[model samples]
Target chain A: MGLPVSQILLVTGFLLILIGIWGILAHRNILRIIIGFSLIDTGIHVVMVATGYVTGGTAPIIDAALGKADAAANAVDPIPSALVVTAIVIGFSVTAIMLSFAIRLYDAKKTLDIDAITDSKW
Target chain B: MKRVCAILAVLMFAAMFLGLVQAYSERQARSPLAEYYLTQVPRELGAPNVVTGILITYRGFDTLGEVAVLFMVAAAVGVLLGSKKEQRAKTSSTDGKGPSELVRTGAEVILPLIFLFGAYVIMNGHLSAGGGFQGGAVVASGVMLLILAMPASKLDHGFLSVTESLAGVLYVSIGILGIIIADGFLDSHVLPLGKFGTLLSAGAIPLISALLGIKVGAELSVVIDRFRS
Candidate 1:
């Protein structure tokens, strides 16, 4: 009757990615850039989980109602969700590293302006 | 002009992404491989949660890589910010007033409960929706709360690093044990599969999941400690 929820999620994720990129490009503050990066990471994670969605499927857990034989016809894809779990953790680690770098940069130059830290800029 | 160009570039990227999404035809059980995991995981591994099964068993090596990546990040962050000279110089910056008594009491009261919930999530990972990563993050949040509330309290860096390393070694050893005792590296058949949907079921998956939870929790605590005062 309408576009599936998966497509909607995909679109929403795309929009988030765009917003993140806009933030990164339009903002000069180091904290905002890191925030933009984290947003992009989240958008990617959402798109990943959305890619695995089935039209009318349940979680890929085998229980009383969902037996082994019927699991194939019912369960959503598990691979992407699992990968997304990994992606989310890695994203957090990367964000931490980025923020630490930002802190070090601030400590050195006493500024958070992206343009100001351009000693090596070509 | 640069702002206009950035907007145009982002719009172009969005247009391409929309085109890709429009062409993507959604399906129920799209891949034969996913179908195999869906049906075979329950029967073969006795793990109810196919995602958990696949994460800790089918694609266990990938998970190992992910863990390694996190470990590297933690170490990298430490090296980046853990300078002794900087530590001495930054004492004045971090000596802000402590959190109020109400917040301190609240954190004290809720810390153990948060730990319990994190354990529940980790322990039931093989049988439920939550898993080691989610549980580990929950635990990290509790650690974060303690850091924020007390401010004077310190997480034992030595204990955390030792535990993290020990867990990493144990995880690898389990994988190697699987290669010897079962089909291949990280194979869950190293132990008895027990019964389906039970806590003790799923062979080595639950064990690995627990080890993962501890390892991730420790690593995250280290990251938080490095970032904190």
Candidate 2:
């Protein structure tokens, strides 16, 4: 059997997630970690939306020319597409908040290295 | 680096194999809300874009929450960074030579086009792929270009704040109007639906999109202004 587009998208998404995780875990810079977080979010959104796509499905919009039979024949789910828009907005806001925090941290501490940001002795 | 690459390669291979198997096994599974939203929501809400119907009507509370988060972030950033004395001291020390004439001219030429495109995106959202958030981002980027190309001293913080607050209040009030006039909060049929696939159709979707566009545009400009040194 031929490889499905969904499978390919899913595999690429998972790989991107792993890379993002690795970046977050291994990087010393706080900005790098934030970038990693964004990457992970993007990967998850891609996978979530890709899962909604069927092998042979039409766009969600109704066309009168298609008639009832053709409309019922193949149509991909629109719910995930709708949900993904929300997810994207939420992701953007979160990224903005995180970046603002990073800026504040830099302003107070004068450095971006996570290791140097420790205020309390441990 | 080599070890990391190797591990990544192995993980990729494993994930590909697993996804193939999973797709083969789970081919028959169906999403419950998928059909419900597609058929029922359009008929009840009278909005052609099911996505818009779901976002602004069925789950509008979530949209309100998202807008609140953005507002909170803007407020927090302002509070954290708003030290007028320090800013004034810093500005005085610098020579304050304004931006180059070329940059200012370029911004004057480009800003109108950007705003027009943003409006187009918001207006055509129901018919096409884009919506409020994307259009809002585009508008913000345009505002950013102005800040970059013009002198910082020329940027009016008061006007920006007024625009931002008004847009935000309008957004919530529209939702409340849905409650008062239509089914509930953010009901799409609060206004006339016009006809499907047309610019004036989808009732409140275009209105909400325009509101979101303005709010996002103003908020992001404020954010960019905060970081400009």
Candidate 3:
């Protein structure tokens, strides 16, 4: 194969991070910025899961397909998958908080533009 | 100037990560730690889903912390947008028209199915790809759908919070039970590890998954409900 699935996923995740950063820096709308933040979060999750992949490994589950005896050679790492589960949940909570903040800001200034809030400007 | 900076920053990150492209291609063997979990979880925990076994028992403390973080977010979001804007959000800016008859009818038809599916996912977590968080999200999405269908409907905040807190307390109680009886905190061995690859096979895992599903579903529903207004 030219490139393995894991590497492709890894590269795609990195690209998503860069795109998210550019979106965050270049956008003025708070909603767009939040979307960018979510993109970055997703990118990081992908990278972490990709890092745990083995060359020809299946899921870590020891079902009928992969017996316990063959688990070591056949299974991908479960740690990253478990951590990503936490990461994904935390990411959703953070996104929800960001959205609530965005709405609060919109309510106060009647605008979603970051430039509209002058009190926080350095 | 901002555009140039954005492009330059993206380019810099791209260049920096190019090394990863090469490093990731080589075949990698399982670490000793991974190997340990892979073999031991099935034998010791009797949960076919190794990931769920790890998440619910092995790294249970971290999962507890994650749940705490979600609880805080729900509370913070409540504090942030829960007051003063009720009338505004209730009125809704969408021309005051509710969802269409098709959506309402569809929601009425499929809402129960969605809830059942979420519960199944949570319950069968140890034997399958589903788990508490994923299944809990599925449940919350059902709540979201309910919200979407019935704009004027009100969620029982008191009931949801009670469910969330009660499930959390019970979860911790189970963990403590593990420490008292089994190897350590949140150990699955507290309950008898039944036959492998069945719904009730894993010791305490199905119970934990149920508790997690209930807690997360309640918390996320509260968050979603608060966001409604």
Candidate 4:
């Protein structure tokens, strides 16, 4: 058979990470760099989420659909799901902070180009 | 030169990932720790949603730190973008006219339902798939829709900060109560674990979820509003 669904997701996540690295290294605009950072964050989250998958398992909720007994066998990994949940919020917070810094930089330098703001470059 | 360097870096990453590809096969079973959470969360915490149980109760300290990080971001963003100078780079759609009539009407109709759904998601976190984070995002989305519809309207800082701080204080207070009453910090057993699969069940999980939802919603709304300046 072909690669499993989680592998496909993992590959996609890795590709996204590669693309994000390219964006960061190649792009000079501060906004694009922020976008690159966001892409990296998203890629990592996707990978984490994909790692949580079980072959034929369902969500980790303890409803009638997913009975309490042997719930571990029936459900996907709750830890990764939980960690990803927190990670997503952290990612949002970091992105907001990055954008805020970008805005302040743009205000002071009057340009979105990173190379143009070389005051701190040594 | 930058392009070549970028390609080289990407290739390096691809090589590294290729080395790890063998481990990416289908997962066969949960780890022992995952098994413990999947079983004990329901039995001890009485929260149906195992992930929610883990985040709110089992991993409560981490959640507190995460919330603190978010709180710090909101403050930092406000400090960064919130100056007295009154200079702002507008979103390029500025023809001096506000949002379209359709957008305004749609926001008016949908805002209440969005808030209602956010509350539902937060309250039903222990019972279902969503929790404070997702529901709080939904609530902030409603605020975003409002901001989109009325670009010139200003959010009240006084009200937003009050609500955010109140939720945060109450959340920590409940965590302390857990020390006094139950096992340890953020112990959900401070209150009785009412009934299985019911609204008021799951000890303090739903309460914590609601507090988290309100705090996150307010913090995010403040953060989103910060982009206005």
Better of 2 and 3 by DockQ: 3
Residue by residue across B1-229, what tens digits does model 3's lDDT show?
8789888988888888887776656447988989899988899899999999899988999999999999999999989987876477656765687899999999999999999999999998999899889889999999999999998888999999999999999999999998999998988899999988878889999999999999999999999988875
Ten consecutive residues with minimal summed lDDT in candidate 3 chain B?
B86-95
Candidate 1 residue spans exceeding 4 A from truth:
B85-95
Q: Over the true interface residues, superposed, what is the Cα RMSD of model 1?
A: 1.3
Off by over 4 Å in 3: none
> For residues B1-229, could you state the per-residue lDDT of candidate 1 as single tens digits?
9899889989898889989898987875559989888978888999999999899999899999999998999999988888854664478456667789999999999999999999999999999888888888899999999988887787898999899899999999999999898999999899999988889999999989899999999899889988874
Ranking by DockQ: 4, 3, 1, 2
Which pairs in model 2 have colliding backbones? Answer: none
Docking class of 3: high
- What fnat does each of the candidate structures reach? 0.86, 0.25, 0.84, 0.93
lDDT string for model 2 (B1-229, tens) is 8558757765775577576547542233336677677775555655555666677677878877877777777777677666654764586459767778988999999999999998888776666556777787888888788877865555577897798789878878888898899887777778887876677877788888778777777777777777565
lDDT of candidate 4 over B51-150, digit per residue (tens): 9999999899999999999999999998898884344645434557888999999999999999999999999999999999999999999999999999
Candidate that beats the other on lDDT, 2 or 3, i.e. the better one: 3
Q: Which one wins on DockQ?
A: 4
lDDT head-to-head 2 vs 4, winner: 4
* CA-based DockQ, model 2: 0.39
- The TM-score, computed over Cα atoms with residue i paired to residue i, of candidate 4 is 0.96
True contacts kept of 3: 0.84
- Evaluate model 4: give its lDDT: 0.90
